[model samples]
Target: MKKKHNDHFLFYSESKTKNRITINGQEKQHAIAVLRVEDGEHIQITDGQGNLFVCEVESVLKSSIECNIVESWSVKRITPDVTIALGLTDRAHFESAIESLTALGVKKIIPVIFEHCRKPWWDKWRRYEERFKLKMISSMKQCLYPYIPELVYPTILKEVLEEDKTHMIVADPNGSTLKSEIRDKQTPVTCIIGPPGGFSATEISEFNRTKVVYVKLTPNRLRTELAATVLCAQIIGHTL
Candidate 1:
């Protein structure tokens, strides 16, 4: 098996100023003992929020590695701000969703609960949190960007729809095609996706009541993971 964090490795280092950072804990051990990184070698680092730093390793101490920032820059976040809310039904597919969407520069992910959602889904979601966060860190590093996408889970569908400030979109095979023409330049957007079994008729009615713009990704229905990933990528493409 491939080693963990062989390339594009990233970790959380809180720096009030971006000029300096200390990599401690197991990460420090990985660099000093395992990676055997030498002084004067440059490496990448991030604050987990948009600021990326390229630094030269000044020294490797027993407890931590110290580095001096060589270059500092910020990546521009995507426009028509996007958040993804979905019901996760498959463990492997859900991990794929997180990996793909985060690399695409999505800012937020909300794991929502709906009427068609089964009890088994909840159990799987709870068990996957640790792995999910690790996947986020990996994706954050692989993408070579700074900001870590926010992951919110166990959120209720009704409560999410009730957010008045953010404009909403729903993924349904029945709705009209979504394109740049349908994009709203003014408000932040949140796209909602349902389970593989699909939401009930009453749930669709509630979506309409909440004024969600329904869009169809494909003529045929898609799995929840594919639907959410595709919709997020499409919106991000338009914004970029």
Candidate 2:
């Protein structure tokens, strides 16, 4: 069998098919200073909006480089409309959760501020997003996935519960097994996991009133990040 050609490439919105693509700004720096891609080499570019282009380098220069598009295709790889809302935790753990969920093919991620959440790191929110996007891009490249997960600004936990209409499952240590709670369900699902200290009594009551089912992962308690991963895995399996 002949080897298959890699046709899917991601580029910026400004890049055009016939025009020479001058890779500049931060992307240029990374390509030249870091990856050291040379002229005549082929690469894939995406607009991060499902548009992909295959291109070959025409010239390489400091701060900028030019490329010619050889072929192009639109991608349609996206997970089912399953969203995840996670209570804000420490920066390190939260970063892991964001990257893991993005790699797992989540549609949207909302950072939830719960009653037991630590003080908000308002100033570093943008940085967190940048890091998450970087992770998503890397995962997209590795997994050959076309769709990028959207990260929503942090919101109050109650607000998410009120706004959510899909099947909601809250990871609770004192709740029913996830397998039992989610088995045979075919609707779009949204999972919520609380912070390290867990949800307060008042918050639990609010979620209960909203008809959010509490699902437990295991008998032994797990960290907030771990719980989120477990729930996401289960949801993905159901969708598959």
Candidate 3:
């Protein structure tokens, strides 16, 4: 098996060659200014596509940082792709959810504007999309994860329900245990977490109309962000 660098800071770069890689934008600035990475220093890097590169810093430029690849390998993606369809909530909570889910290796996140979600919050999602992305990238690097979770903003409950045929797991207080819902690791999952206020009657009715499994994460109420992270962890535990 290939060795893992658990302590080195992981940088992200899409521009890479067989034996070379370049870190640009905020990541470049971070390596230079914040991490103070210098020539001949080794750093771990990911392409955000399941590949990790252990590299030695070649030079630091005014615009970007260049590195020579010492070794590289691919990390397999987590099995049974997990997608989180979370209700749009307050900025801080929603962003927190993004970070938490990314660290758990969720494949994708869809921000749905459910009935309980405030219209103002939904409207602001687009403006904060970039910031949300940065949070995912930060979380991925912190956990030394190879891939950044995909983010889709400004959607609705109805749209998600009809998006695909994957198994849908809805987080509810009065629902059944998660163990019964997640049986097979090969089956893809789309876990839905409502806003902090919970899903409305109409939304519940919509769920009833379609096929979905309701799993209760806990008997007590949880904040929207916490509920989302819990659900992701449960799915991973059961499936793995």
Candidate 4:
């Protein structure tokens, strides 16, 4: 096998018990037309579920490509798994935000609908589902991270408050710095952020009512997109 960019070669979205991996859609197009991979060539494949399947090209077709699985293994999930619950925002901006988070190794992204969030932001995901997904996929490829962050939908803040498995951290300018809160090193963290205009008073009261921790970075307020990523990146910084 010839060497290329070893950080990332290619990946399959699906990996099961079979000895071969079948790749279709844009992955196939890129492999055949762009990468110019020939038979017997080696490529990396991932199921986006912490598993990496090393494979060799068996055959290439117009619509898809086949590769014989050479070996397979799983990467351990990141410790202190972080989930970013993002309130809806501009489509392009949210896409960029999720893309950056996925690259940074976030385990999950929940597209939340807060009380002050714009009404149109609720179902906006349905419109750009494919494009947003592609953004994360491309981000994963660029970063050479095998596991793609799980994307969840327009959940309400109240509903998110119910998840007890994660140590929920809500973002507020009045809250403490990111470095200060996770000092206890809580695992399976879920950090929640408000919309462009910020969370409503009632929502804050509800958050306070819960056992959730309130945390912030600087006295200077950051945009929702930057804030969400900053919190996640900060978690990684502390964890590592």
Candidate 5:
């Protein structure tokens, strides 16, 4: 089994094992203001590229801090290549979907605007992307994963399906069982989740014509986020 490190770490630039390093810019502020790390304190550092460095703070300043690297190792993370394409919904449901997908180790998230979706909000998209990125990063840090999930801006559902020939599974409560529908699928799966009111009849027909298999989670209806999470969990659990 691989060894795990149990030490606090802050991101920094100019990190090298067995040598002095420096932390500056936003990272410096986060370390000083937020963490209040002091000199001679041991901390881990990463270049955000699968490298984790063990180091001790040498000095602290207003905008930067210097540290000496004691040890370094490459971090490996388990990230699924599955892509989750979800229809845009209310802010609460949208945010919940992002958080749940991140926790489930989804690699790519594509927010789709369906026929029944509310009018797009550019500000909400930007804010949600930023917040989702931070959440993914925090989750990755907590789990010691080296990669963060990617969040794509809202796009048209038709376009996404046309571009990717992935194993497509759409969640429909009245559809076939999930296990029977997606029992044996390879990687790079793409699952589509509709809005709260679910897809319209016309939309469902179009989806079926496009060869998107509809999978049912349970007999009881579920919220948009709940359906998305269940489908995602099934895909990840089965694939992994």
Candidate 6:
């Protein structure tokens, strides 16, 4: 069986049994219309939950594609399980950050509503949740990654900081360098990136009171999205 190097080469589906998997909607359309795969052709599929199924096309329907699983295996989640608590920014920036973060294999993402955050954006976060989800999915497939980072609902920065967690790192301009802080760390980490206009004075004081390590990604300031992608890449490098 010749393999096709099309975007639909790897499909995603959550509806699967022991031996069969059914893909519908956009995934089906990509397979049937874009890739134009025929029955009996083998393709790769992921459930976006760390499982990859090597399936052979069984039937193509008007609205769905059926395949028989010939082989399957699970991919382990990235170690040190890094979660990024990014302060909410504009829709374009937030979406771009998640796309880069997802491709970098972030385990989870939490949209934070910091004191300086744009209140209007957070107030209507739910309305754009689906669009954000689709962006993450597209990034995952583009990278051929097996898992989609868990996208948590928007939460206030104060509440996020209050959560009982260890190994918390916050991005700050006056903080210790990234190299110095993350060295020799061997535990799950949650990195926080402040939104535009930076964290407020009150928020800075809140950080001072909490047990969080502040890391300076660079000598100069970075936009919220770049800071997040850079931070995530730095952590991933350290983990490796």
Cα misplacement distance, residue 238 of candidate 1 (Å): 2.1
Query: How much RMSD separates candidate 1 from the native structure?
Result: 4.5
Relative to the true structure, candidate 6 reaches a TM of: 0.94
What is the Å distance of residue 29 in model 1 from its true position?
Answer: 5.2
Task: List the RMSD of every prediction in angstroms.
Answer: 4.5, 3.7, 2.9, 2.0, 4.5, 1.9
Give the better candidate number (1 or 5) by lDDT: 1
For this target, which candidate reaches the highest TM-score against the unseen true structure? 6
Can you give the lDDT of residue 192 in candidate 2?
89
Model 2 Cα lDDT, one tens digit per residue, 1-240 = 222234443434345546566777666776676666778888777666676767788888866778887777887544455688988888888878877776677778888888889867844687667777776766665555555778888898778878746578888878787667664434667888888878899997787688888887888888888888888887777656
**Which regions of candidate 4 are displaced past 4 Å?**
1-7, 15-17, 119-121, 183-186
Worst 10 residues of 4 by lDDT: 1-10
The TM-score of predicted model 1 comes to 0.84
Clashing residue pairs found in predicted model 1 = none
**Lowest lDDT 10-mer window, candidate 3?**
1-10
List the lowest-lDDT window of 10 residues for candidate 5.
1-10
lDDT of 1 at 201: 90
Model 5 clashing-pair count? 0
**For residue 179, what is the lDDT in candidate 4?**
76
Model 3 regions more than 4 Å off:
1-7
In the range 94-184, model 1's lDDT, one tens digit per residue, is 7888887788777888887777777555555667787887787778777876767899767778888887746788997877777833546
lDDT of 5 by residue, 48-161 (tens): 456777777888987778887778888554434678888887876777777777667777788888878875664466656666666665555565555556777788877877
| Per-residue alpha-carbon lDDT of candidate 4 for residues 98-193, written as tens digits (9 for 90 to 100) | 989988899889988877676575465677777878888888877777888989777888888888854889888778777766755457899988
Clashes of each: 0, 5, 0, 1, 0, 0
Which stretches of model 5 miss by more than 4 angstroms?
1-30, 33-35, 46-51, 66-80, 181-186
For residues 74-101, could you state the per-residue lDDT of candidate 6 as single tens digits? Answer: 9877777889999888888999999999
- Please list the residue runs of candidate 2 whose C-alpha ends up more than 4 Å from where it truly belongs after superposition: 1-22, 180-186
Error of 4 at 146 (Å): 0.9
